[model samples]
Target: MITRIATLAAAFVLFALPAAAQSLAPYKDDLFAYPATLSEADGGAYRVVDYREMRDVNERDEVPERRVRKQYISLGVRSQQQEMKLGTQRFVAVGTQQGASMIVLYLHGQGGSRSQGVNDFTFGGNFNRVKNLVAKAGGLYLSPDFTDFGDGGAAQIGALIEHFSAQSPGAPVIVACGSMGGMLCWKLASDPLVAERLGGLLLLGSLWDESFLKSPAYKRKVPVFFGQGSHDTVFPVEKQEAFYRKVRGKSGNYPARFVRFESGTHGTPIRMTDWREVLNWMLKS
Candidate 1:
């Protein structure tokens, strides 16, 4: 069963790569066509990487290296102290292992809870394939319940970022926000501390808010993994691509990838192996 799933995941990966490169080609000329006076290195623009190359890199033959068997262990009852509380909130840790060097914080969507996030992020006990990659590299995963909706929840998310960052000083923090969680993620990006601490951002079925996108802190070298569904009713691929173009317009060499899931809805993109692939990249790349 695992073998079959792996095969299917590889197939999906092949399909996802095309969307990464093709999504913003046409907009490049109109969006990033600056005069020769402004050099790309001077923050004008940088050549967009060919997404197909990622596929080639994955195809290379590799040694049979030892891997940490991913185990979804429960890390007991946890809660946010009143001072840091954005509102009544709690969280649960789910991953193959735990440590300080690398941490992944997944923010749930509107009305979403850790219960739903755990099952969704882990694909209901199939275990994240990337967990081994992360564990071997020394990292853990965290999923939190955002009872506070809208931008009001940003502070709580920031508090969590602060907590984890403080726990592991100098550790790279990666935030994977889905749907409404993306809103809070953007709000957190505006914060100099949170923006400085983030190693990467993953937008799953979420749109970009230009308010923070154009900020200097956000425009830094932090990588962004954008996952979108062609069939997503709330926020379609068009919106994701538009956001990508907007960001790419300002920062040419920004490490942003658009992973498209064909015929997928709002939730399906979150259920793929892509999450682990991107998470590992954010941590180990």
Candidate 2:
């Protein structure tokens, strides 16, 4: 609990500042990279494959190569003066929640509010910017208050999944969780009902406990794109690599990949990297 508080405090404090002082675009190449080869189970996990293994793999898939213009429509959340309000609901949509074919449910880190997820783009090169780009690309997006997903989080997430499924029927759902919010994601992915409708996972500086990892969800084979930093003090990079390798070593073809940021701290990678392509790949990986 102490650690959670500390991390949350750091996140908000850091986000309150502008990134122009130390933006990631300059260090883009030094901090970002994708796996050269997608792992396969051809006799040995070391086997190479020219094509990425997955149902969404499309070598021909095209993604935006530039920073997109940010767009959004405030849902239940409203901000004016120095005050923020929930209005009548516990969440807010960073983009239109209309006929989007895909929904990106961004779960913010602990002690953070739902409003911060989309409103914090002022810091630049942040999740809100990524959300804006995805939204502009015709995706439904939301970030719920941390309180909604804590004691009663699972039910809330399940309801959103159900709502999106009913709204768009076969549209895929992406749970883009960060930090403590990821705890809910692990449980959600483990659920048989939720797992079936999942498009992919965008794990940004999140952690999966040993137990959930050993559960049936571990074998779900959902395409997961991780953005983790080498200098993360909360969760070490070695553990992330081990989990990736283990998933790859699993019996089925798992489309798993990670962007190892050489010098980024825990939240820096999440805040700095160009996620348009990564998010694009997960939707169609």
Candidate 3:
């Protein structure tokens, strides 16, 4: 049964990759791109990025958590904030609705709502950049609100993916989970259906699951990107880095990448992650 599932998983990923070839169009390439890299390892699969609060936060935000530079946002993107009866869940949808070439979904952490992923001003306008990239590349971007970070929430997100994916057949689904939202990411990975549709998994300032080694997504070779902060207090960076190393070693060098933000804290990865760079890599892989 395991071998049969793995074969199907690989077949689905291969089918999904070709449609995701068109890379994301540039949007504030100079401003949103990652800054200087501090170090690199494992042939560039791992990197340490230079991050400073004074520059990445203070200089970018006008009121810390309230607002950001006006230039960082492009309000013209056609985004619809609505509720879907699929699971009675609320979500913010951006970019093309039908026949989308790709699909990107952001699942926010605990104490956050669907709006957090669509906030153009906060998080150094990182969310705004993703919206523009998806819109220009003929893709769909969704940020949804779920009941909790458990099986119930995973079912809600899975239903959302199935509904949108039906509208845009063969579009690769790349899920990005922040903080506690990683719980759903792992759960989705274990789900055979969701695992088959996934192009990649982005764990931003999130946790790890040991069972992932035996998950269908692992057998499918779905790419994974980990963004961590060296100084994160909520979830220690060491544990995540250790798990990342284990994943690479266990999978004989899996399609996984890690980016460590030197001196950054819990929310730094959410604010500093280069969505274009990460998404493009997964699309091509």
Candidate 4:
């Protein structure tokens, strides 16, 4: 195991500079990046993104849900939809399986599965962009099937993190949680072991937990990115904004960010969050 880890570390060093010292190499910024930033604060950590359904969704997709074609997906990346078992936990990993310099895991919301995170053409192909970015950057992306959103599921996710992290010893693990998946994110944040492994947390159109203010991850100052839609009916945006303010108030220098998509709905963040920009910020935080 030690020899394998050493080999992975060597591979990582050759892949790119240490994650802390550099940002992710650009993938397709011209196509996948967010539109004009309406406003920003706290050194650009907090901002409002101008989101229009006509441009962000209708124009980008050839047929909305049915197809996005070459504009959104690159069929070349090695995105294996197969399952890997860690004890009893199962997951679908996209990108390099071993010797990764960075690790990203997307936890789907209620009514979503492990497949949701790896789907190339869905969610405006945001997931596909993430797959390509990590692969090109020599990293790993995981979409796991968990039992529940409570302790059991968080433990399952934590175990997966431990297993992959062992393979890529120093790789930073960033968990991007959507909607109900935020429950698991908060649970993981409260766990010291998982918290130690986390480079950051991306809450996309997700709920907030007041308890997070006292979590181990918070104490450790783990960077956090909150992307929400201003018009979200489920999990009101105002409440989320209040929470972001509290996080900032708690620590004047905490590595945290909030991106509000004006006039967007509940699923807007998943479809619109800029993976490259946010992940780079966390890696360099």
What digit string (tens of lDDT, one per residue) describes model 1 on residues 163-221? Answer: 66665666677888888788877777778888888878888788788886665456675
Model 3 gets an lDDT of 0.85
Q: Model 4 over residues 1-285: C-alpha lDDT tens digits?
A: 211211212222234423332467887788878889999987787899999998888888888864665777786664233456676666777656666778899999999888889888878888988988877777788998899999999999998898888777788999999999999999999999889988999999999999999999999889999999999999899999888888877556888899999999999999999899998888888
What TM-score against the true fold does each predicted structure earn? 0.64, 0.66, 0.91, 0.90
Q: Write the per-residue lDDT of candidate 3 for residues 11-48, one digit (tens) a residue.
A: 11112223445788788989987879999998899999
Candidate 3 or 2, higher lDDT: 3
Cα RMSD, model 2: 12.8
Off by over 4 Å in 3: 1-19, 78-87, 250-252
- Ordering by lDDT: 3, 4, 2, 1
In model 2, residue pairs whose N, Cα or C atoms come closer than 3 Å (at least 3 residues apart or on different chains), thus clashing, are 56-284, 56-285, 57-285, 149-153
After aligning candidate 3 to the native by TM-score, how far in Å is the CA of 80 from where it should be? 5.8
Off by over 4 Å in 2: 1-89, 120-123, 148-151, 211-220, 250-252
How many Å off is the CA of 176 in candidate 4? 0.4
Query: Which residue window of length 10 is worst by lDDT in model 2?
Result: 1-10
Best by lDDT: 3
